[model samples]
Target: MTERARLAVVGAGPAGLAAAIAASARGVHVTVIDSGADAGGQFYRQPADDLGARRPQALHHQWHTWERLRDGLRAHIAAGRITHLRDHHVWLVQRHLNGFTVHALLGPEQERPAEVLADAVLLATGGHEKVLPFPGWTLPGVVTAGGAQAMLKGALVLPGRIAVVAGTGPLLLPVATGLAAAGLEVAALVESADPKAFLRHGRAFAAQPAKLAEGAQYAAALLRHRVRTYARHTVVEAHGGTAHGGTADGDTAHGGEVRGGQARGGEVRGGERLEAVTVAALDADGRVRPGTERRIACDTLAVGHGMLPHTDLAETLGCRLDGLDVRVDDEQRTDVAGVWAAGETTGIGGAALSLAEGHIAGRSIAARLAGTEPDPRGWAAAARSRTRLRRFFAAVDAAYAPPARWTELITDETVVCRCEEVTGGAIREAVDELGAGDVRTVKLLTRAGMGWCQGRMCAAAVAGLAGCALAPSRRPFARPVPLGVLARAGEATGEPEDD
Candidate 1:
């Protein structure tokens, strides 16, 4: 009997779960690793089983899809075709003469080492939110738009009684409406992108009527909640209330009463929690228009520019990158042999695109490992859906890009890097005074990207402030590793050679 190839899948998101199910159905022995407590990843994030919620599906949009993926995974696991390692944080993947070794930290403590050996590896690591900072962004009660949603979905908790959702992406729509539906008083949905941009991509937008309808549904929900929307606008600064003393109306020394949405007082204060956020209109060039500032009172601020692909593992394996995302062929195979990538790592398309890509990749991987060429006809429907979704999201990406001159909103004193507390003044000094040209030089000149996050939150902002193009950082390890794990890995299999 021919032995089935062992495949290791990183991530338990829609892409990873779908890929595992598809490959296992085709006789591939699969092991799925994820950092979360359960399957479903971030998109279909569910409440804890102990929550005993009556209607968990109310928090999700495409509930049926999640059920299918979840059930498929369970069936495969029961049949001994798949093994799921939950709460496994993969730090690195090293290619060896025999196969590949996936090194991961297990459990909440993340101190124990676990390794998976496989003849082939599939990366579905997903993406992270891009946080461009303004004044008071690091203040309490200021969470990313996704973070707010995750709290709602995973913990069944609202960020605050009153909230303001601001950013430039499709994510804002759901975050705002979801909060409102959950009984939070949503003050505003401030969007930085001009709505007129969609008109330019009308043809592309019209091609996907389903996407259009989905957006319309969100709009209807926002209308039902009476959520005020401000197009071509963005948050300039968030004002928090102090414990020392403030007016009954939440006014502080730094900020006074918001008259017509404009703060009439002095400088903004960073207190224990967020109280309000100042928003400003953007001009055609993406710069904040003069005298258009408004302050909306709110207890929480949920903000995010967009998402950035996680390419650390793929980059370490010498896979090609198309701009910021991993470059994959039609079968979702990377240029590197015995490797495949799909989902947000390929681009920032949503869940539908990810599922299609994952299914195709699984079919391709299963066939190739069995010494047969994958028939394109087998995955034709998925490929077609992938193409359509890619085109549709391309338009969405173009329409929702951050304002061209968003950097203008950052004052010299505003903290850009929250990890190291690096201010905008320090970044400017690195460029103008220190003569640093690129992000690397700026990081070296000022300890901007050297903090705990390793620049994941601040890299784009730093690059923008420095007037440089953003590039993928080739990190050897995806997550921080204990020195002991490194030493043990070296002892077990010798140190990995440089590519």
Candidate 2:
């Protein structure tokens, strides 16, 4: 058995990195397991080292903060206080009598199983984008707002040259401006949420001036690039066609190594590439205004409704959840013993809030492992920042909710579940024709959520079409594991569990 208390952090984004550094500083051994090739999670996704990206900071929002975290993590790893496990997809974390057993799959194929035993687990699993389906949503050139950002940051590639960024969130601001700054002609930023609604949460908005300034900066960038902004408008459908002369994306694998080049638009695959998107103004009721439909020519549609917390692992551990997010106390402790959650897993607050929560949780974990009660005053500064930032983002989330009546626009033929090719009409029939009263029933009837993604992409859309609350399916495993891996996961794997 190990003498130093070992903690497992199940992400490497802003939250997990912060927690790992904090815990390591407090004489705790930390293992950060993430699926990315590097430490920075999606928000601070690092370019592959071989690419020699000199200006990676240009693509990130908080470059200085990221630099500090990255440096600290490197220092800790060098000192052997923390172990960084990259490309390990954690499928399930099982609570054991000793502590916890984290079951993960190694490499991209995810055929090989790996296990890590720890005294506690900090879940910073982050979140995923929610893209509501419309006609032609399954087209090749369309990706989530974060997905577009990921392609840019991770692979050093853009989605397309001419793009319409249609989404309703603070995320859209960065994405639209980032694309424009990267030389993509942003045709329009179509936002479904009305700016007028922001006034409702004035006090919450007033709490954080920095966040407001951030939004202002994004708005200014949009203007400098001459990107047209259509307030209270939404994408009705995407149009696809054959395109010639697509920009070659950077650094596709060559001889098992990433080739180096400047970031560029991704090469369009042979299928029909995105050519345009039909946008329409939304009425007071958030329904599309009939006569306001306009077709904007673009090669890509970077669209998203908002975000949903990744709660599969939490559910598997039987952690209490408040609606869609995992429930946590002030120190970011989950209801389950020895489990702490921060970042988007707790809620959809931005990176700063995640950092604060992560710091607090890490400190708490260290104190608990040492068999001592944590002093609230220890993390007082972070707690204050957390409270203020949470208020600020609550207002932002309120103002940026997807168009209230967006479900009304989804045509019967629209593919709601891209994995299963389940259409909106099939979901409606499961609800209206059959006696399906919930998303689970609808899934069973139509196999909408039974695909490889296991309902991650379609749960919200399926719930909306069936007029049911988007409840957690409480999946047994966070992700699908191969039968070979699951058959004897505990007996043999990578290194023996450090129990």
Candidate 3:
């Protein structure tokens, strides 16, 4: 048992960082916990401390916001008002009488269970890429767009010499451009969204012309790099066997690791690594439009559909969720007492919106805890910003909304969950023959989401393939916990509770 903090914020991303700063400034004893060794989350990932990465800002969009937050955090830490714990991967959070108890795996070397008790908790767990399976997605040299970006930012290494970035979101532009800027021979950018969606929501786009200009600048960069961008396109397969094969012929390691590949375009020769990938146009149903398939020689495949909020801790506390996302009021308070959420954990509004939301939530919580009436004025402007930005996000969502007929694209032999080797036919049988309408039921029958990954690798694909509502998975631990830690959680002599 440790001294209880006035407030605890999970995630070191923009939201949690800003919230901690605001709360501490208001005289609230705050603790910010995160998995990163530093304050920035995935958005502002920095290179390894020893790497001497001088131009870290070059890899991020809102560099100033990070600098401001980081400085504020340092000031607070020096003053002893805030306790910032980096590399503290929170595994479990439970609501107590007047507050909550948080369990975390602290530091890279320390394995002992570290617990933090708090009067209030704010969840800013952030989000991860949604993996929608394709025919050749299970191949070496393939990675999520964000994952590839992380490699460039954190390790200062490119996944390959020639990379093809394909996805349906605005993130693809930056990833492709960043790889190209790093001297990688970017083959092309394949987007699955119709460009007309911008026109459909012209007002929203007009409201954020800066975003449009940013996109335009990225386009100009792509042009300068001689990178071809194909809108309304997708990578059908990653073939290692032949230049024209429709299937990927290598090992698939999801979640950011590129197993193997070599450049194979122009001066880049392909021999023992990723040689080529098949790019194609998807019909309205998300299936490969037969004749649109074209072989594009490349060394790496970077792809992602979108992102989903990480809401397990909030869900475990029985906080009310709006659809799959945590339902937060204008002030970012969840239904559970002493709990709040902001940033991508609440919803996907990118880094800028996350900072604003975090500041609002922090201010609101600080005001209420100090026995003062919550004015929520600062948050009002932030809310408006969130609304405007979310509209653009909604437009993007609608544009890339995975086609309804994509479930039919999966062949009976195609593996739905690579971890378990569960096939499309098994999932279909679970749904059609076994009356499994929901994801849990399908998992129970087909064991698709029951593999080592615990469904992180295949949840989005399963949900989309089943045409069911995508829900945030609720588990006792945020990540894999040691058995000794579990035993330390409680007595080891008792039998496990029945499901």
Candidate 4:
């Protein structure tokens, strides 16, 4: 390599930002590309500069850490060690004999092609929310829990005047509190998971006292705001009220998803929106109790089950996966050469674990790129933090498991895939009548996952209804590519060349 070794960090989130700064500080040239207009990823997302937020820190618990990362990145960029490319929607990372070529759409339209050449790549692609379908979920005002948070954080707006935050993961806590803090009338927080179930993992809880205290803080905030929280309760169905002007056909609700049309122009528009939702207590077996049904009125139904790692890029690179997460070794290196992964792409352990893993990956990559053996002792502290957080999150995952019988609660008429307008009944028919036993077969038989999203939003629901694990759908590219971009990709390209 005649020129300095160039590294491409494919996300601007906690992990990618940390890795980029660490590697660049060690003399590596880095290009940080992200789809967002700003450097901060979802966790550190800030209101637009023009918004002139009075106190953006009020929205984040880790604001100081974000300022550190942001300042470091700016410093590196000024010194010519790093470059931040905003609004670059990367669709593929192709390995060449020389190194790698990252293909991306240039802007919001995601049509014009752009490419970046790098000697190595880090896959810090992050994760997306997993929303199980329920009746009336397609109502205009129904949004994901994370989506609601992003709306508040990014756009600095409320989804509705009254909201119900319902989910089964740790993310629901901050989301509900944030909504209440933002002055939204939080009607209730309906959690399907049993709070007592967390006690079963006492060892994990004891190991992370700070995490326990954080939960207590959220509980206190909810109490102070008089936000009703129903433990072991699941949303059986969302109900919509009369529309003033028009009705929505196929409303979408996914957070930090690759798919488009998110942060929807929600109702308050002449669109039909959520008016109320039915919640029911779950039995020991995770089945809903018959007499426990109660209706809560709210204009917004913010619901989520959990989150899944983004592995499309890793899978395309022939990297190994442990379940849905991209598998990585101690240094956060993927099985594939010239590739490293960190953050939620490896697993959804939250920001702290992502930072730890990213720091380790950055230090390791720096050593390797400099042709030196990486000493694990260099990142021993980060590695310890990584291990502890991983253990705690593993227990968290188990404790926050979605209701066991959630699939049975969805009415046949409920739309499962909002992109393609496929219904639960259609998916079930593909299984029972068409004899489709797996997710791919169900997709081919009923077109359940064949929409603009290509199954990202509805894969979990489809797999559950089909009684199968989501088979690795090896997409040629991470997202849909226009025919024009594909045709032009083969022609003489004007990608920046090394000096």
Q: In TM-score terms, which candidate is top?
A: 2
| Clashes by residue pair, model 2 | none
Give the per-residue lDDT digits (tens) of candidate 1, residues 342-442: 89999999999999999999999999889899998999999999999999999999999787888877889999988888899999999999898788898
Clashing pairs in 4: none
Candidate with more favorable, higher lDDT: 2 or 3: 2
Name model 1 segments beyond 4 Å from true.
Answer: 1-5, 243-271, 490-498
What would you estimate as the lDDT of candidate 1? 0.86
- Residue 346's lDDT within candidate 3 is 80
TM-score of each: 0.93, 0.94, 0.89, 0.93
Best-to-worst ranking by lDDT: 1, 2, 4, 3
lDDT by residue for model 4 (307-404), tens:
99988989888899998889899889998888999999999999988889888888888888888989999889999999999999999999998899
Indicate the worst ten consecutive residues by lDDT in candidate 4.
250-259
lDDT of 3 by residue, 1-499 (tens): 3446899999988889889998899999998888888888888887787766666776677678778888999999999999988788888776655567778886785476777778889899998887677666666677889998887877766776668998778778889988777777799899877677667877767788878898789989999999998877776667664343322222211222332443223332243345688777877656668898898888688888788888888877888888778889888899887789999988787887788789888998999888787886656877778788877777666666544455665677778799899988888888888888888888998899887778987887788667787777776667778888877753222332222
Locate the minimum summed-lDDT window of 10 residues in model 1.
Answer: 250-259
lDDT of model 2, residue 67: 92
Off by over 4 Å in 2: 1-5, 243-270, 492-499
Model 3, which residues run further than 4 Å from truth?
1-3, 108-111, 241-273, 284-286, 490-499
lDDT of 2 by residue, 414-451 (tens): 99988898998888899999979898998899999899
lDDT of each: 0.86, 0.85, 0.77, 0.85
